[model samples]
Target: MAKDHIDPVEELRQNTAQPFEQAHAMPPSVYTSDEFLNEELEHIFSKDWFCVGRADALKEPGAYTTCELAGQPVLVIRDRDGELRAMSNVCLHRMSTLLHGNGKTRAIVCPYHAWTYNLDGSLRGAPAMTLNEGFCKDQYQLPQVKCQEWLGWVFITLNADAPDVSDQLAQVEEMIAGYDMTNYTEAFYEEHVWDTNWKVLAENFMESYHLPVCHSGTIGGLSKLEDMICPPGLPAFNYHTILKDEELRIAMAHAKNDRLKGEERRTTYLLAIYPSLLITLTPGYFWYLSLHPKGPGQVLIRFGGGMSNDFADDPDIDQNFADLKALLDDVNVEDRGCTEKVFKGLSSDRAVPGHLSHLERPNYDFAQYLMARINAGRGN
Candidate 1:
């Protein structure tokens, strides 16, 4: 619970730095280093809490879903008692995979040895192997991963020793507590495979620098280039800029709606959870994107819970969402194109690590945060 506590939100309120300042960009090699990427998988993605799926996916008592984080396959299931559990999706005997994809299963049966596991991941049966001496189901139970459900999202941690999820995401939780996210639900979920490093995707989500050029069709008309971005100096990982519709802004002005008039409205709040999770919220809905590093040149992006259930029945909701999704598609594709170029260039002899820009203080902070973790791994 203490991890959920945040520092002063309004501290260092003004930043006079320019947007593309040198201090903001991460070093060039972060995109191309297979060694660095593997270290991130171990220290950041593997150990930290990640939102794998929604609790709604496992609505039935025996419902189940399988996911992978940093190449580690995971299984989440709803038991007969209605409790949700997560575990490694590998069979204990010889460590073979158990399930292929997501589905409801009364018990997971390993194709390799025909070992079976209960919904809670306890050893259920190993067939004739149980007849052998010193073979005990209790000792062979599937390794359990720490999992928790909060704000309708299911989060799992690969490291049993990692800090609690709430503590790890405390600043994000505090900033979003006023948004009433409990009323939201997933109306759209899409995953894209990009030929870029996962860090590039995380950088793309942290700032709206390319909104006018890339997302001109959807957000260009409504978002001012200058106002659409937050000034530097806010907490690097938790800053968000809200971009509101002009009509919505005028209506709020006439009605004196306190929530949408000031910083809370007409802004895009871009938050980066160190390593590879990005949370962005708009007036109509919020989008949670998790970037998984598949390899040195491949990244898998999972888009989860992009709509509000409160407006599900509204006639205009679908149209508005369609436009938003279209804009995001354009933005994401544009980013992919650029990142892939960067990925290819990282191997160039000319490409070397560089300093961050002054306006890019947040990016610098994020890079520092990343380096701190990387350094920790070397016992430096």
Candidate 2:
């Protein structure tokens, strides 16, 4: 007798139905199935806002970066007027990508055929095209993608009808106003393609439960499980607060910072912005990882970090950032190992889910968010 094949969407519905206390991890197939990943791409990634990186990274005119979103090549650039714009990276003539990576360029010239475009995506010059009788460069322009800057982060979307990201994250703005997140200087940024399901890494970041074990060599000793506070998530995001041990002075407020008071001075916020932005914000520093699925078992990560203005005037600022960057690099190594192992386990036929821990409220909430986004506009 053949066993009935289970539908991934059906499993997702069942997982999301359980109350937080009675919740269990999502089905292993959700992370390992190619069919489910395609569905997510069609729905969530295609229609929702995706963060690329900090706004300040593209501060100068002609600064630009090339990336892929929802399988479309995208170019994010600063125009001659110093304004951020997102456009199709595909050239108008024969479809060659206009840019490769992050750098500054006075104009976009296709490497394949030398088709030139202004920073604003206007067709600037096309060599030898004038020989053709009916060709007009004025008629060609790269299609624009919707872009907005929110709290110092640059987000773009292919869907024009999607809600504004700033309006969607109003609660987060109110909650972290004391920290003035926009003023945090980005000291370093890097891109890494890791071997893991994007969702697996996202869930790993949503909870502190794994820290004491998975991150034992780096940040584990500083994270005490008892100090964590996990609450039910809101629609746009989920977050957990941790009270840092005062011995970790950088996690505590500096003398220059007067906006934070009481526990706010000693608290750290771990924020999971729905779909794929993960942020770790402390009183003195902030770091975030924005993920995009590369395949069924791979993820592209845009990782960056910086310190708050309070530490801007410290005499040892250079040494302090060097030490901080070193620690962050070590943390990334631990996290990559842990998340890749989870993905490997999920690939096995015998893998089954167990009940969620009380501290995994965010993961349960994340399941609900995923189901809601995937099933939306489908009339399910």
Candidate 3:
């Protein structure tokens, strides 16, 4: 796989023309290989700024949650002092699991050996260590992971040695710099398990070519398909698709107030951060989407969002949330159905890496980024 001589961009350019045609498709093995999936888990997911949840999840002191990322179980907790901590969810003794799920707890007591850990991941007591055999309690704390909070979201990386989240995410940060994402609060959150590779979903999200057909009922008639589509530049990590008010009003009918009439609706934005996080920002609406690979052919998608401050307590917010969820569920179902069917083709012997049209610059960039990382043997 050390395609050192393979110019991935050049290869993509040859197959895709200016208007951009989806030329070269991913090879079959990319989706069905257990080996490649493991590599992605270790190298991409573990080392990247994987989203755990929103900062609001840890709003209360001693609030804790458990989640899995790249096949690794993780414990995220807000300590008594209101500091957030991320640690391996494995017990130091016998390597058993620690926290079971999300809850508020003063401390975590490992069920296996009753080994207890403080909210900050400090080893508090080891009930079974009677020998005192040169073992310091301080040395037995749960292993810590790199973590950071940005724009009201909690992100953690299993690779303690990875680059700073800011550094790795600079391009995306710059692209979304003008938006005030922190102003909103979590108004929606959900998760779905899909039967396709995470990259497939990423590729689909990075482009809008399928929006008209795949999301016709929800967004097609509402958006200026041609105008919203643009070449996603060198962030090589993500892309942005703009939707103006005309389209927004049509898709999100609930947003049809006089304040957003005509030109006022020209401010919808969709951004995909490198690796997995997707954020859609509007005049007063926000949505967060995170995708994670579960196995070779399975990926999990989590949804989160915030609303405008003015409407935080509005009862209509519930209806809006439900509507948005239904819209997304339809889109998800459409994407999953087509992608799973496409997976069968990608797994066929007739497949090979396809080309990218000029419009697929983002997709090409992402493919190149992933390939370069893998070929370089960089992993968590």
Candidate 4:
């Protein structure tokens, strides 16, 4: 006996085509199939504005970080002229990766050979290249990738025609105007690899349907499904609102600011920005997850958050961050357990699409985005 083969693209289009009231989850194959993952890497992630990290992380001139975007090695640096740049990390000589991790350096020197590049990615030195005929060092700079900074975050895209990240997230900026996130400073950052499909982790972040159950001991006690408001997805993002019954403990820990008032003071906004940017905003704090698909069953996550500048300047800021990290870690543990289980369940041959709760509207919209990207790849 064998499982029935399903075409992920068609199944996704059909499932997402149903009305919101009648929608179903995408088939398991969309998450478990290698073919579908490859298609996603090419059509969606590679062609979209993918967030890497905060611009503040590279605040000083000569600061740099290396990361992989859709399996392409990318180097992001701040030049001596104070310009932010993103470019291929591969060495022009023998194709070696030029940098690893993050650091501050005047030049990028390849480990394979002494081939060095200036901070701006211009070829600075090529050891023993004089033997090569017609090899112009001036013409051998690392290929450039499109990069932009929006509201303090750095985003890069492999697609030459992709819309600027600022334009894509313009609505999000307006929606969170009251919070003044641009003035926030990162309090902490961490990276983790989860044993779950990238979409599983993404959809998990989009909906609060699992909060009262999955996150029972942590933030769950502060929330109720009835208090959750599911807003429709925009062309580039989807958001939900959660109203606090009592003033948030974290908010109380910080000094009050007039930036947020009335219901905005008590409401939390959770946004999934298209392909892989997940953000959560409270009156006093903001955090985000920048996700990258490592494979069918692995996702690399960059998780971090910051407090309002006023809050960040508090005398007890260190203590506040410790408490926040503890709470966030507990919540992340719960999410990891749930999503890993979901990934295992998705592997079952009998796994099928399930009806979505009204609260899962963001997940529904995500499926629509996935379908649209897949179809667009085929020019359909």
Off by over 4 Å in 3: 1-23, 128-136, 244-265, 313-315, 352-357, 378-380
lDDT assessment of candidate 4: 0.86
* Model 4, residue pairs in steric clash: none
Candidate number that wins on TM-score, 3 or 4? 4
**Error at 52, model 4, angstroms:** 0.4
TM-scores of all predicted structures: 0.82, 0.98, 0.82, 0.96
Per-prediction RMSD in angstroms? Answer: 8.1, 1.2, 4.8, 1.6
Q: For model 2, what is the error of residue 273's alpha carbon versus the real structure, in angstroms, after optimal superposition?
A: 0.9
| Model 4 lDDT per residue over 145-217, tens place | 9999988888899999998887888898988887777777777778899999999999999999999899998
TM-score of 1: 0.82
Writing each residue's lDDT as its tens digit, candidate 1 over 302-322 gives 776556454566667677777
| Highest lDDT against the true fold, candidate | 2
Model 2 TM-score? 0.98
Full-model lDDT for every candidate? 0.66, 0.91, 0.69, 0.86
Q: Tell me the lDDT of candidate 2.
A: 0.91
* Stronger candidate by lDDT (2 vs 4): 2
Which portions of model 1 miss their true places by more than 4 Å? 1-24, 229-236, 247-265, 352-359
TM-score of 4: 0.96
Name the TM-score of candidate 3.
0.82
lDDT tens digits by residue: candidate 2, 231-295: 99998899999888887777788888899999999999999988899999999889999999998
After superposing all C-alphas onto the true structure, candidate 3 shows an RMSD in angstroms of: 4.8
